[model samples]
Target chain A: MSDSIAIELRDVVKRFGDVVAVDHVNLQIRDGEFFSLLGPSGCGKTSSLRMIAGFELPTSGSIIIHGREMGITPPHQRPVNTVFQSYALFPHMTVAQNVAFGLEMRKTPKNEIARRVQEALDLVRLSGLEERRPRQLSGGQQQRVALARALVNHPEVLLLDEPLGALDQKLRKEMQLELKSLQVRVGITFVFVTHDQEEALTMSDRIAVMNKGKILQVGTPTEIYERPNCRFVADFIGETNFIDGVVIGRDGNYTVLETPEGLRFRGLAARPLSDGTSVTYSIRPEKVRLLTPDGALPPDGLAGTVMSVNYIGSDTRITVRINDRRIIDVWEQNTRSTLDRNEYWQPGEAAVIVCPPDNALVLSE
Target chain B: MATLQQQQQGRDRIRLALLLTPGLLWLVLFFALPLVIIFVYSFMTNDALGRVVYQPTLDNYITVFTQSLYINAYWRSIWTSVLTTVICLLIGYPLAVFIARSPQQWRMPLLMLILIPFWTNFLVRIYAWQIILANNGIINGFLELIGVGRLPLLNNEGATLIGLIYGELPFMVLPLYAAIDRFDFTLMEAAADLGANKIQAFLRIMLPMTMPGIVAGSVLVFIPTLGQFVVSELLGGAKVDYLGNLIQRLFLRANPINWPLGSAMAVLMMIVLLVLIMLYFRATTEEER
Candidate 1:
């Protein structure tokens, strides 16, 4: 992807009567990048995408698509296409006809339209089913037709609104990879909107986490997952154990946090923190190492009792109760096939859960 | 247990037969029997004294085909019915779409308004139109007060058309509403997103999807208008003569009542209606398949 911006939203706001669906937001998506708007339902992600597609007029801001200001331009006038969540395939048209509809609307030469339609059908692996109506296809097939119909136009940008939400679990996984590869092949900017965090993390080059009509953070998958700037992003992206604390001191790049129980913890702060500032320290379950009580203890390790041990085939998820009130989960991967079943941690056993200071995140929101 | 299953199946068949018998018997007795009697009567001649004559002859059929008066009435009926159906479609389509796209609370009320005219007697409604379209009626008087001068407003083909369209509008709107209410509007947005303007999207998506409604509404309006007698009699006075009026005069008003000629004309009209209905079914079924 180039450094040139393909779409830029500047102070964009959209209100539907009494409800502000998209609050004032500013963003810039680079050319050919697979960007995602990740959030729960009704979080203004779809509204932002619709504004970019010109389906909606921004109440008080500007949307620039490839350097052109999209001010109240109708959807048909914009150089963008959308794959709707409902897979809005024209029922009266065949697969080829549906794909050719956009080109026909633009009044392209008949032969050229046919060629592009065939090419798009081949891209989605639906070449042989060109003569069939949308009703004759399965859910996955219909979605492919919707994709091809939009892609055949060779639009400047493509917007997908939870396009894989209706598919089965296995099919959704396959299509996530398929859609990512398709974006790469076409070399077009894809602004995908999805509520499924795993789907966003798996497919997007960059993700903008949003909630309540505002964008929380925008970064790569690992950056957003590992160095989340707020509690909502950390909690929404993955399972995290939060321990409330007050910053007592600063140790170079790390902050020393003291819990109410007089337990001290040290972690890297997402932003600069002053002494005595209230903060919440978060650590992913997989980042904490679980050890036996008799093992060599790290200086910063907290002694706790194992409350529950769940062996879920791939990993052994153990919840360790720290101090009197705080319970933290530790995940241990099943990397070996030892014959002894007793190798697993038993309930009520004393355990030491150590979270390396570097892996801990101090979010002050 | 096998015998019990068979007995249950037999009872189900008998139940189906009992449910269908009433409708089937009504059609065969009141509909099919009359049609057969009319067909037979069309070939028999009436005596000069208006007495019954069972002698079969082709003279009545020849007269029906060759007489200019009967032929002119048939053509006029066809032309007027076509005109009425077209106008009804033009007016009803937009109204049906408006009602279908209306808010949830207003849809039923709007549809109810379309059907309120049916609660009153059909002939009474026709008479109401007669009073409204009369030369010295309320509309003409209002026009004169507005300085537009009194115009010839009634007892003409135009007045007959207005009455026919008003009476048949509800039939057209109901079927169109039913079809349009179930339409998927999201497809229109998809069209617009793919680079189609408002008019193109409507033509390419909405119109094709609602074809069934158009066909149904047109057929409903066309069939009844073809045989409409009261609208012409009340609005056209004695100046207009439609197939229905002609048939009524033949069987009931003519001296020594020409039942044979009336039966022949009725059979010919039935043939025309049957052909039109069959064409409609064929066209719709082809599209569905």
Candidate 2:
């Protein structure tokens, strides 16, 4: 894939009356990259996607697609197509006719339209059902038709706004993988808008995590999960245990934090913080190591009592009460396939919770 | 177990009969009986003393089919109704779309405004149009005040057409509004995203999708206007004689009351309307399938 920017948004802001739907969102989507706009509902992610599709004109700032600034350029003139959230397939047209609509509008020759429509349908694995109307197809089939309809246009970029939101969980999961593969196969810039964090993580080459009309973070999946810059990013992406503390010292890249209860721990911070500054140390439950306190406690580890233990098939979740007040979770892989009670921690048992210094993340906010 | 199943079936039959009784009774009394009477009357003759004679005759039916005046009236009525329907569709489509796409707060008010004409007595509203289109009435008065000569606005085919379209505009607009209102606007956006310009999107996506409403509105206007009497009588001042006016004159105003001829014309009008409606339904249903 080329690294040249396929689409760029410079301080794009969209306001509906007094409510700002999208704040000053500046984005650089590289050519042939599967970029995802990830957030909860009403987080301006879909608004950003709509603006890129030219469905909406920015209230201020400018959007440049392939280096040409799109100012009041209607969606029909833009070199991008959208797979609407509703799957928005033309109900009156057959699947093939719907797929051929764009090329027909462009006055492409009939033979070429037929060839491209077939290829697009086959790409989405919907070759046999070309004659069916949208209502005749299943939800998944309709979604495939929508995908084919948009892809047949061969636009420079493709905008998908929660296209698989209506599908059942099993179908959604299947489509997510299929969509990612399709994007890779087509090699077109895909700006996907989805509220499902896992979907974004699974499909996107890079993700922009947005909140309240603003993008909070943009990075690769690993960077977003491991090095979340703020408390919101940490909580939104995945489950993590937060230990509130004040910075006591710095050890190389790690910030040493001391709890009000006088327990000390070390974690990495996005930026260096002054000593005595209040901070929250975050560490994923899976990163924490649980052991019997009496058996082999790490010298720097905190001691706690196991409040609860849940056996969740592949992993056992152990909630430990530290300093008699704070409850921290520790996830342990169920490596032992045998169903033995002794293999997992029991409630009210003494335990030591420890994590590698690099796995812990410190949030100043 | 056999007795229980039989009793359940009997109870369901009674319940179904109870639910259907009133509607069936109404249709039989009002619709079926009147149609049968009209059909029978079409084959009977009227006496010279303006009284119906209990004599079956083909002469009245022949006169209706053969008379130039009746033929011209039927043709004029059919063409005028067609014109009215087309005009309603052209004007009402955009208006209905505007109302349907309007903000939620404005939608009900706009719809209520369209329905305001229906609240008044139908004749009174047509009478109001008569006054408005009259030479010395509101519109022409305004025109004369604006330094333009008073054009003949009333008692003509043009005035009658305006009246028909004005009276039927709500029928055209309401159904179209209902269909457009229920439409998923996202499809339009999808069309635009698929490289369809505004006109293309409207023609292929919006227009075809809203066809049920168009057919419904057209049928409502066309059927009524074909047999319209009041608009032509009042606005056209009997200058524009349509099938409805001819039937009225034949039954009441002619030197000898021609009940059989009028009844035959009425039956013929009903048959024409039924055929048109059936054809429309067949075309739409086949397209849907």
Model 1 spans > 4 angstroms off = A295-297, B1-9, B49-52, B280-289
Error of 2 at A68 (Å): 1.8
Runs of candidate 2 with Cα error greater than 4 angstroms are A295-297, B1-6, B282-286
Measured by TM-score, how close is model 2 to the native structure? 0.96
What is the per-residue lDDT of model 2 for residues A176-230, given as tens digits with 9 covering 90 to 100?
A: 9999999999999999999898998999999999999999999998888888988
Give the docking tier of candidate 2: high
lDDT of 1 at A102: 99
Local lDDT at B105 for model 1: 98
Give every collision pair in model 1.
Answer: none
Q: Top DockQ: which candidate number?
A: 2
TM-score of each: 0.95, 0.96
Q: How many backbone clashes does candidate 2 have?
A: 0
- Cα shift from native, residue A67, model 1 (Å): 1.0
